[model samples]
Target: MIRTVLSLIPAEYARLTPRFLAAVVAQAICQAIAYVLLVPVLKSLFGDDQAAAWAWVAPMLVAVVGVLVLGYLQSLLGLRIGVGMQADLQTRLGDQLNTLPLGWFEGRSAAALSHVVVDDVREVQGLVAYLLAKVIAGVVVPLGVAVGMLFVDWRIAVTMFVAAPVLFAVNSIAGRLYSWSDRRIHDAAVESDTRVVEFAQAQPVLRAFGAVGARNRALDAALTGQRSAIVRMVFTAVPSLFVFTILVQAAFLVLAYVAVERVTHGPLSAAAAVALVAVGSRFIEPLTQAAQLGTTLRSGAAAVDRIAGLLAEPALPESTTPVNPGAATVGFDTVSFGYETGKPVLEDISFTVPAGTTTAIVGPSGSGKSTLLRLVARYHDVTRGRIEVGGADVREQPTVTLLGQLALVSQQVYLFNRSVIENIRVGRPDATDEEVRRAAAAARVDEIAERLPDGWDTVVGEGGASLSGGERQRISIARALLKDAPVVLLDEATSALDPHSEAVVVRGVHQLSRGKTVLVVAHRLATIAHADQILFLDGGRILERGTHDELLTAGGRYADFWNERSRAAGWRLEPAPVG
Candidate 1:
């Protein structure tokens, strides 16, 4: 455990910097000097025959008071420095999280990351401040007292010196045991966090399925693991305390025997022997402090490792090229993509949506229609070929620049717990209140807002659970309308709506897509029927492509899918009327 803790000290020191170390060292030295100087005056006070003893007593009191004042000031300085360091670490961690690839977030548990960033980081601050101060004071003060002991009597000093090796060996073994248990405890904490998040997220489903008892059992299991780990940690620490107490008692016995022998031989004064006993009794204070600090240091080192791992996650390469989206034309040039190796999601997909036109992609489930739309927004890079906007590869353009040219309204709308107007403003932060209201009206969100408590200022619960699905979709559309990007990507924008609501949202979508390049993953036949171009995808390949009328005439995958959907919706399949 000492090895792990010692490894973290250099990192903490480096992070805190030389100035903080200097302050801590200066404080420790001052405290040690105060103790050494007070010993003599304290010894003088013991004498029965006083020759103006108040003179020495007053000076000693003043010096002790001065040391206390300096120590308080140093503590305040260390606290400020620690808070500042923690703030810097949090900022860096937040920035690193944003820069990491989306897939990194997919693989990790959000609750575990949350615990490390919040709870673990806070622990580090306490550990760094308390353990560092204790270690410094423990080493300096103990060494000063040992030197003072030698001045009183070399025999007592020799006993302390001889006992040092035994103390080191005991502490070293205890430290290793503490470290092993501490790591287990930290892991259990992370697991508990993961289980809590999972449980909360699954509560609705669990309740729907009447599986609350099952979930409770799972939670109990996680808590049981955490309790067991903590119990093991206590077992490791309790034995160390026993050993430390025994060692301190043995040291006192040796000092007492040596003092008696010296007094008998007339080599030590009686007052000096009494002072040596007083100092020897307090000698274990530093060693005990150091032992407790070892545990804190070990826990802090584990936290540092977790934070470092988060920061080390891969980030997308920075782009230097500026984007000039001349026409908002989106084109896929032989693009191939796979979420995993040897199992392609989209293979050799190629298509183009010209400026000021709507292009609909129709496919069965898992046919990669949404993936293609994601590529246009550059959510994930292509594995092969290129995705270009306005005649330039997206990979060559800055991500901010690429994103600025497009607005996305996904099937899954994620709303923050904020006022409706503020959520809309996320897409265009500088938009005026009037502008936001206008967008909301245009998206037909006003229909739902009229029933809301405060209209546009009404707070939507997390994920917009306060509103119905169709209402959430309208708010998402309002956000996109507010951004007013030249290119719009809609993934089942109207899928959440009832027929009447769908009509309202579809009209709004039509208005929003005016004079802009729109690429839609079409779930409704009505949405695709109006598209100037339609791409029929099957088995990760573009099986057919043409205008809606041309594809219907071709009577291939598009016709088959249209017929199947038309039958499912109970729509009559009739011949096309003369135009």
Candidate 2:
């Protein structure tokens, strides 16, 4: 565990480790000196050796002061190392997260991410602060005490050697029991955290179903499991701890018997016998502490494993021969993709989205329309064929260059916890305030922000909860407009809004996509009537392709879908029984 943790730290901090180790050793020696001097102090007070008592008092005072100074320095150094290591882990973890593929985030909740970023690192930080100190003291203090006792009487030291194996066996048993309970407890805690986040986010849906105060069975079960694990751990470990305490006491009993025998009838003086008894108590203290250190080190070891596992997750492969091509036309050359093997969501697809033209994709639910657009964006790379952006194979170009050439505006708009202007500015961090306002005006974002109490300066809550659905869509459009990339991808940009908001948002979308290579996953047929070309998709394949009116004239799947949506759009909620 010591070697594992030390390897994670920066090499510059290597000097501090030995410094703290030395200080802890010095502290153990000082404690022994203080305990040994107590014998002379006691003897002089009781007998006629007044000068001897005064002589021992000076050395005892010096030992006491030395221990206090060493302890202070040990803590200061540990704290410095812990704080530096925590920040370094955060930096390393952040860089690793960026390189991971978006598919890696699937099925991982906000709670799990928070656990890695916060809790796991914190456990290692605590190991540096307190557990490392205990471990060093456990090793150094006992050895120091045993070495001194051997010189006085080798028989008394032999008792400690016998007790060592017994102490280790009992501690090993207790550690195994605690470890089993702790694993269950940790799993339960992670499940409970995930449920809490889900329940809070589902508050609006739960209220609609009249289940606001109702129990969530998954969450309740996880909490109960955590409580049971804690109770079991206590019951199993407490008695075992008492057993360990008795084993340590047995060693002390043997030392007491020998010290008495030497003082009464053999080769020991009264003061020397008293000194062994006093220092013997100090020897037993570290043995008891060593038994508990095993569990503490095991916890730090588990946390280290979790952190190391995440760092080892593979990054998306980068191109050795990176390219920068000229045109913004996108081509899908027999591309295929799937989240899992043997179940391809998109297969053998081929098409072109030309520069400065709108190509809309129309399909029913589960037709892979959205997955098609995601491929061009490289959320996950093609499983079989290659994708082209700016006329170069996306795999051949650097990821940054591919990202720089396109802008995505989807229905799910995520904003930071910052002022309204700042969320819109995420599109181009270096854009001037005036340029931001220009994009906002074009995308109709300024209208929403100006209506708020603080106008452009109003703070949007996490995930843009402070803004309405239409407002967030407009904000996302403004970001795309500000970016001014050559290619634009839209996923049902106005699918979730009312007719009034849809019309206004559609106008904003037009402003953003004008004179750019545009690909849209069209949900409402009416929105794509004037598209330059329309591809009707079903079951991962394009069934028909032509202009909107051209597909309608053919009386195929596109025509049937168009007629159904057109009729549904005209339906109204009114009193039918009045006639």
Candidate 3:
């Protein structure tokens, strides 16, 4: 536990380390002095010099003042350190996450990441601010108090030591048991939270299906599991705590017995015996604190380990000598990738989108069309072979530089909870308002902007929920148009638009993609009918490739798809026969 905390303390806080150490020692010493002064006071009370009692009173008061001043400083410094660590951890995590591949994030739940950064980090901060001070003082105070008692009477010190082994043994076992239970409870709680969040997010669909309870049964089960785990932990831990309490009382009883026996054996005066018994509570108090504090520190260690795991996850390695592509040309040479090993989504795939030409990839659902576009965008590295842009292998180019050369517009567009103008400006942050407005006009975003009360400044609610699908689609196209990258990856970019908006978007796309390398994943055969080349894929391999006219004349899969789609376009609901 101590090792975990020391590793978490950043190097910049090195100076604060000694300051806290001093505070802990000062606080502990003051407490020991306050308790030790009881001996002198008791001696004064029974001795002939009754007026000398006033001398012991002043020093006891001084010790009390010292404890207060040091304790306050310790808390203030500890809180500042805690807050600083929290800020640092958040910043570091964010910076690292930005550099990670999209594939890494795809395998993890958003709820799990949020819980780790926001919830678990806060709990760890609390451990440092509250539990740490108690821990330091708890360890130091007992040792200080024990040394003072030894000077008063070695026999009494020996008696206190008799209970030391028993007290420590019990505390050690309890701490281990509590830490095990804490980790289990922590995991259960996280699972419960993840289930509730996922369930709530899908509530609209669940309600429409009238399967709210049935669909969310897993959430119900997760919560019930958490409750059962917690109840079981309580039943097991309470008995261990009872044993700890019993041992503490036994130590106190043993100290009192030894003190009376010493007086009977003439090893000490009556005054000395009374002082030994007077400060008996202070001797065992620190050990009791340690027993309680151990649990919290151990939990903090677990949180630290979790955060460290995130930081340690390998980021996509960048090229040391990065190269710039000579042109916008893109090539996939025998590329293969999969979410899971041995389950290749695209295998031995090879293709090229020549500069200043359009290449359309058509495939059935789950046929790796979208996955191919994502690879060209370098969201994930090719697992089996190489991908090149401008005759240069993508792996040789720096990720940031590579990203700057391509603009992707997918069917599902994402907009921040910001102004309509700002959402469009995401394509190029440095673009002027006038430039953004020009792009918006080209993509027909201005049509929607005119309907809004605030035009460009209108706040698009979270995920642009306030806007219609066509309006949002236009805005996304406007952003892509503003980017004006050399290579454009259009993944059914106009799928959400109405017929009128779709025509306007097609014109804008033509303008944006003119004289650029274009790789399009087109579901509708009509949209890519005039593509420079078309690759018809099925079962992760390109089955046929040619111009639309050639493919139709070939009377293969493309022709079959075209005939089916054409028939699907003309189908309508038929009137049921009266029976």
Candidate 4:
């Protein structure tokens, strides 16, 4: 357990560990020496030697003072190292998050990550700042006392050594019990946190459908489970602690019994026997403390294990020698991918978008249209083949170099709670105010801002909740326009908008896509009739490919799809015939 925790400490903080431990050791020795001095002082005083007793008293006082000073230094070091370690751990976790593939985030809840970063890390911080020092003293103090007793009385020293293993066995049993309970408690807490966050975020939908009561049942169950786990832990802990404490007292009594038996036998004086009994009492004090600290040490170990596991998660591999893209062309060579093994979402797909041209992916639902676009963006590496961006394999290019060449505007737009203009500036932080406004005007975002209470300065609520779907899409398009990348990828950006808003956003899309390498996932066939090339996909493979006129003339799946959509467009509701 000690080695596992030390492995996670950053090098800078690990360097102070030796100094911190030395102080704890030195303090434990002083405390043992002070207890040993009791034997000599009491024996001398009872023997009627005032000068010898005073001489022993002076050094005992010095040992006590040493203990006090060393303890102060130990605490100071622990706090300094603990605080530094907490910050470094959090920073490392953040860096790890940045390097991970986007798909990794898809499988985890935000609440689970939050609990690891906020709650588990805080527990580790408590370990070093407070619990570690006490736990160390509990160990070293008792061992020091046993060694010191050898010179004072060999019989008592032998008794303590004999009692050591028995005490350790009992303490170990208690620690194992507590560790089991702590793990369950931690799991329950994580579930409770996840349910609470889900409940809070889904309030609008829950209330709208009158399913709030249904959701409340899940939350209540989570809370109840957490409460039950905590109660079980407490019940299990008290009995173990009580058993360990009783065993410690029993060991002390055995030591006392030995001293009394020796006094009645030959060669041991009454005064020295009395002093030996006094020393025996001091020996049990640290032993009891160690048993009490068993739970704390186990808790710290559990927290460290959680932190190490997260840090050990693999990050996406990068090229040793990254290549820079030379053009804005995107090519897929027999690409195949899936979120899980043996469940391919795209299979044997091949397509290319020449520089300064547009390719529209048109398909039914679940046809891997958006997944194909994401492959070009390299959300996850291809499972079977290669994806090329700008004439170079995306895997061989630096992430920054690849992302810098393309701008993505998906249907689900997320905006931080900040001013309207500030959100647009996210595209290019170095862009001037005039440049931001220019893109906003091209996307018609200026029209939406004019009605906001604070105009361009108004804070768009979290996830742009204050804005309508069409309004958010306009801001997203404005962001893409500000980026001005050589290639643009749109994932059905205007599919859910009203006709008026669709027209407004389409004009912005045209401005953003003009003279760029474009890959668009089109839901409405009419929108992409003029695309340079169209791939009609179904069941994870492209079944038809050509220009709209060519596909219509061929009378394949694409032609049938177009005819169906054209007929749906002309349908209208009519009153039923009178009965």
Every candidate's lDDT:
0.77, 0.81, 0.82, 0.87
Residue-level lDDT of model 1, residues 470-515, one tens digit each, is: 7888888899999999999989767557888888778788878888
Best by lDDT: 4
TM-score for each of the candidates:
0.79, 0.84, 0.86, 0.90
Residue pairs in steric clash, candidate 4? none
Candidate 2 vs. true structure, TM-score: 0.84
Give the C-alpha miss distance for residue 117 in model 1, angstroms.
4.3
How many clashing residue pairs, candidate 4? 0
Candidates, ranked, lDDT: 4, 3, 2, 1
| Candidate 3 similarity to native, TM-score | 0.86
Minimum summed lDDT over a 10-residue window in model 4 is located at 209-218
What global local distance difference test value does model 1 have?
Answer: 0.77
The better-scoring model by TM-score among 1 and 4 is: 4
Indicate whether candidate 2 or candidate 3 has the larger TM-score.
3
lDDT of 2 at 87: 87
Q: Write the per-residue lDDT of candidate 2 for residues 420-476, one digit (tens) a residue.
A: 889989999999999999999988888898799999999987787778889889899
On TM-score, the candidate that comes out on top is 4
Q: What residue pairs clash in candidate 2, if any at all?
A: none
**What lDDT does model 4 reach?**
0.87
Lowest summed lDDT over 10 consecutive residues: which window, candidate 3?
A: 1-10
Off by over 4 Å in 1: 1-19, 33-66, 107-110, 128-131, 143-208, 211-225, 235-274, 293-297, 334-350, 362-369, 381-385, 493-498, 528-567, 571-579
